[model samples]
Target: MLTYDVVVPVKLLAEAKTRLSPSLDRSARADLARAFVLDTIDAALAAERVAQVIVVGDLSGHVDEVPAGVVVVAEPEPRSLSAAIRHGIAEARRIAVDERVAGERAGRRSTRSHRGIAVLLGDLPALTPHALDAALGAASRHPLAFMPDAEATGTTLATAAAHTRFEPAFGADSAMLHRALGFHDLSHDVPAPLAERMRRDVDTIDALDAAVRLGLGAHTTAALAAREDRGAPGDHRTDAQPSSRPIDSTRKGAA
Candidate 1:
């Protein structure tokens, strides 16, 4: 069994979830974006195989939402999802080195033993611990792996086993890019609800509504409820994947 250091990248709230602008006002979108990252982190931390979580983003505004014990690395300059994830992977390597040194000083086994790196999109508010664990368990068998999003057109998760190169090409057509980069796709055969939960990355109103139907994390649930309480107008009953249209290309960088 391999324990993973899951790295999640969150784009600036102001620039995130732009496609949802039609469904939520700027302020509301920011709130919901914060909720999405917070909820994703919470679920990642709960995964049994996840040993550490490295969040790469400028979360100064949402500092209070980040749980204690999780690592926070500053987002890279120019702010692309791939850059953020690369920074996080660097941080993970640093942490692993430090742990190994500490273990050596204590005359114990290397603390980084059986460790892997996984990049999970911060937009997965519907992701559950069990679903993540299952995905990770499957990923552990491969040196490099990726999971496509619900629409099967984008990537939601990418993984690299210990001692493997962490080359993540996350953006538009990420699924195809990852496949071209030799990452094994884990989307072929996975259990029903687990796979569904893992693939649900909220982007458009339809996607958000789908996640809501699948069950959202506490933060996301509260954010939506707060909007409803404020009498804010938004669509929460839209059908999931109503069209054959792909996710907005402009909203590609960060999951």
Candidate 2:
């Protein structure tokens, strides 16, 4: 089976999930963002077709810690989502090259199978290993492939095989952009429920509610429960405006 090195990018905590500000305080939003990343990573790590999960961004003071076996790539200066993914892609390529070289020096063929690179958004609190694997299984058929977000206007996953160019267009109307760029859309290839799980990225309160209906990952569930435990301050604003930042495949502050 084809395997993939997945790259997930997060924005600085303070800047993440600002769209949900009216309902949550800055600290709460940060905590929620961190939880989202954790859950997303957990799902990616659990995926059978995934070879490695590379996280990109400065998570200092945001995430308490990441689990072992996951690689953390420092976010590039200027904090562009595209740049972060590109950096991760570079790291993935480097790791692949190093593995091949080491195997050659050992006078034996590499035990690892052919691998591809996939950029997955970090805001999929409800993502599951099965959903991701299903999408990736479809993606493996094409040199370049992408999965659109639940709304079908954005993207959630972008992938490229080892021999192809890894061009990730993930911000603002990303689905259309990827399609225009000739990346195969794998939406119809996965089962409906599993595809919804892969596309359920959270940015707004309504979106979170939708994800909750689908069942969220452990960290995301805990994060929400924590809010209730703390009696969540009186900052609830139902009229909160959506974040004005460029809407990406994931959350608002991905850049």
Once fitted onto the true fold, the runs of candidate 1 whose alpha carbons sit more than 4 angstroms away are 234-251
Residue pairs in collision within model 1? none
Model 2 Cα shift for residue 235 (angstroms): 6.9
Clashing pairs in 2: none
lDDT of 2 by residue, 1-255 (tens): 899999998888778887775667898888888889999999999999899998999678644579888888789998798889889988888888898899999997974537889999999988999999999999999999999999898899999987788788998889999999999998999999999999888887777777888888998788778777777783322223333333334434362
lDDT of 1 by residue, 33-152 (tens): 888989899999999999999999868777877999889888979878878988999999999989998999999898585699999999999999999998999999999999999988
Question: Superposing all C-alpha atoms, what RMSD in Å does each candidate have to the true structure?
Answer: 2.4, 3.9
Worst 10 residues of 2 by lDDT: 236-245
Give each model's clash number.
0, 0
lDDT of each: 0.85, 0.84
